[model samples]
Target chain A: MSPARLFQGGLVVVAAALAVYPFFGTGYGVRALLQLFMWIALAGSWNLISGLTGYVSFGHVAFFGAGAYTAAILITNAGWSWPLACAAAGVAACGLALLIGYPCLRLKGPYFAIAMLGLNEVLRALVSYFEGLTGGGSGLSLPTLQASVPIYYVMGLCAAAVTALTYVIITSRFGLRLMTIREDEVAAEAMGIDTARHKLYAFLLSAVGPGIVGGLAARDQGYIEPISVFPLATTITMIVMVLFGGKGTVWGPVLGAVILFVSQEVVWARFPYVHQLLFGAIIVAVVLLMPRGVLGILQIKYRLPRTV
Target chain B: MNVVITPAMIAQVVISGLLSGTLYAMVALGLALIFGVMRVINIAHGPMLMLGAYVTFFLYSAFGVNPYLTLPASMAVLFVLGMLLERTLVFRVVDAPELSSLLLTFGISIALVNLAQLAFTSDLRAVEFLTGSFVIGPVAVSKPRIVAFAFAAIITAAAFLFLRNTKLGKAIRATSQSRDVAMVCGINVGRIHLITFGFAAALAAAGGTLIAVIVAIQPEMGQIWTFKSFLVIVLGGAGNYPGALVGGMLLGLIEQLASLFLTTQLSEAVAYVLLVLVLLIRPTGILGGRST
Candidate 1:
């Protein structure tokens, strides 16, 4: 069998293990697995825009909160089913990305990133200031679900789906366009690619996962606050994960998310107070020493093609 | 209800806005100077400012050091920290893509903010100052605010004068214009970079020290200040100090006026709203035309 086939089989086995572990495990184990899958989906989503297109967004929590709030509002006001609300939330988030991305995607380099940062703050303030609609600082809480299992599987499916989508994108013409744009936008435009439109597509594509995940997680947790949902730390976490695993690759985000998220969970469980310090140190070390991330380092060692 | 616009109200608002605006300009100048010369966005800037405030608080409350005297101490401390960070970390990625320095500084920011939380325990601390509200015509003026503003303005002016007139300032200016040209002219561009970062850090610290005189000091306060500083510098233009002053004052006045019509929560977001508009209409910032 080819090595590529073996690698595919390895992925299948990992998925199988993830799928069955909940059944064999206790409730805490399942909850942690759910968190891992959430991180995977979140990090994968971030990798799509920032990793593939090199347009790092500092305000993705805006989309997450948008989705979460949209879902909460729909269910409470319109009597919508939770599942439909989740789907609508995804649409809502995509619409937002489209609206903001059209204007913001025109900015190049750090300006684009910081503009997104400003957008997040604007959205958060808007949500709270319109207290009559969003419950203001008190935030919105949805009806509780008895089982966490459904969210686990939904999040797992999302993680799997995003990974598969990333693989497909990596192999597709659209994905090549994205990486090319990242490499050199001026040259890409010179070569006839619509850099603005493609970036918007990537940004929109990346947003849906976080949107859906936020909706599901909000419902499962039975509560949502603007501060909790739209924390700036979420953006930092996703960026660091993608950067750590190796950006711009199909496998990089997954690798980065699993290692970093799992380790963080472990550290948080053991030494909650020191986790942030640890996380910050890791970020410094990674950017300073292992900037290529784990996969990048491995690729460099073996002299592998960056795209593949 | 067309409530009559009173001249006294206008005087009050103008005084309050200008007072806060000077502090904003002081902080923004530091950020602008570093970005102007180094081309690195120091995300850790807010935390550094917080440190300055914290230093002032501890000194004033603990040892009875004059709050004004904390300015020099804060500057000295931040200068050392800045030099050390520049030599060790920032210079490592001085030529890498812009994202590298951003990420590096972001990491440092997270580390600093969290460590501050751990050390200070998130309690709100304010420097105790004797207060008297002095009236000028129809307006009530805060004495501490007036004094802090004056002190901050003096420091900012001294900094500008130094940059414009001094021999070392010329070297730094030459480096900002073109690092290679500065090198060719035997300016020791590396040393200038180090000194410029240290000086910028000191400026930011001085801003923090002055702010400690009037406002509440806390660990998390840095985030908003950092955001404001960035908005100011970006508005004025990336490397334009005077532009930062204008942008800072503009932001302060806008926020003050906006609070009259909008909720303070909403008003707090005005900087970002203006930022988005500026980026869309004039990405060079309000005064950044043709500079980039």
Candidate 2:
């Protein structure tokens, strides 16, 4: 089969599977599926910048936190509608992305990661420090209701839309420039690609899906706290999911999110300690065995040509 | 208007900062060594330090082993762990892209920190060595703090001697300067890399043990230390030992003085501010020569 056909067929199958999942799995399963969808979106968004552009961001939680805080504050204080709040949250997150990326993105390699890490910590500290605004460490709780199911379906659609958008970008001329920059920034710069603009664009694009997902997550949970909203673990999990599934590939992060989340839940339930150990071990093993991730391994085994 | 900063207070801050800075230097030394020799930024450096602290904590708390005695044992175990980690995980990505090495190490760091948290609940653990204080002129410094300082200084000196005088140390240095040339000259670059990684881990372990004695030991303690060490390494410039020492000391002093005036919370931000200033003014660091 042609690559494009295979891609479309896979997406159709995945979408159909998702549509039927809530019914077969029940309410609890549906909730899990919602989480999976959110994570898939987060991981794929992370991949857009870190994986494709080769700029590792240790501070993605900042954007995620921004989205959560924006939505939560608007809904609770201003009494905004959920969809509008989400849109505001996304815009807020994008604004934050621009604020952070404008200065730090100028540095290369681990410097960017360090800057992002600092930014995340600074955000967390600032949020927690301002008790009057962010409710301090106690957290802000929203009203709970049975409206989460529709929200789940909406989130799933958003995840699918974002994934499709990423797919298009990956196959387009912009992606070619991104890949070239990733391969060698100096060479790309020599070839007349404005490295700074490309990186900023990638960073901004990467922040959008996660921002929306973060808003969805806050609404679904009906609460938001600095710790929970800005959890470093979430960012780590997203990066791990992307890498484990196969970075720089369209479907890799989706596959990774599903696999890691399901396995993590199972592991967390049975033996928590062993589960964490295994998580760490898997990262070590994956780095050693398949530095390119699962899709990379598959490509190597099957002699598949590289495709977005 | 005369605002007097007492000599005793200044002495106290200097003493404390030097002790803490020595430990920071020790931790960053290992990081600097590994980065200098292999060009591999071991994000796992902090986790390894945490592991060392935990190992010592367990040995001391569970089996009633003295922390000082268990320190060497922890270092030895960590050395082996580091070697195994490099051989199994890091070796594969040695030739891969820089991002691969970075992401791989970062993954290992996350896994280790989470696993540590899972294994040992997020509670602070410490070993009380000597709590009494001794008077140095008008300033009084804690006995354990002094001892920890002495231990750090001794280790730093020993490390310097080992790297400067030993044949293996010379070989490692030779390899670090030019890997291809070192290989051409019949030096086992792989062996040097392994030893360098192991040595770095050992230094981290020693620092961890001492830190546990000095302060609280928790799973996430390494995260702060990791960033602090990065600031030190960048300030000292990668691969410059003396620079790390000076950088670490300056960082410690800055934090101490800043805390006296600003809140402790702001002290960390101060470090980052200092880092930014250094990066902006002199990216090679204050004492960093062209040797690195």
Highest-scoring model, DockQ: 1
Q: Give per-residue CA lDDT, model 2, range B149-262, as digits (tens).
A: 888889888998888899998888887788999899999999998988999999999988887787899988887677778788878876687677887898888888777776
For TM-score, the strongest prediction is 1
- Candidate 2 segments whose C-alpha is farther than 4 A from its true place: A1-26, A117-119, A143-146, A265-268, A299-305, B1-12, B62-66, B114-123, B135-140, B272-282, B288-292
Q: Residue by residue across A1-308, what tens digits does model 2's lDDT show?
A: 98769967987897888787766678888888898888888998998898888888877878889898888888888888888888888888888888767665665656667667667777777777677877878998876656677788879987887788778888889998998889999999999999888998999988888787888888989988888988787887888888899988887898899889998777666776555456566666776777688888888888876664
Return the interface RMSD of the candidates, in order shown, one decimal each. Answer: 1.7, 2.6
Worst 10 residues of 2 chain B by lDDT: B259-268
Among all windows of 10 consecutive residues in model 2 chain A, the one with the lowest summed lDDT is: A272-281
Prediction 2 global C-alpha lDDT? 0.81
Two-chain DockQ for each candidate model: 0.56, 0.37
Model 1, span A28-79: residue lDDT tens: 9898888888888888899899888887787888888898998888888787
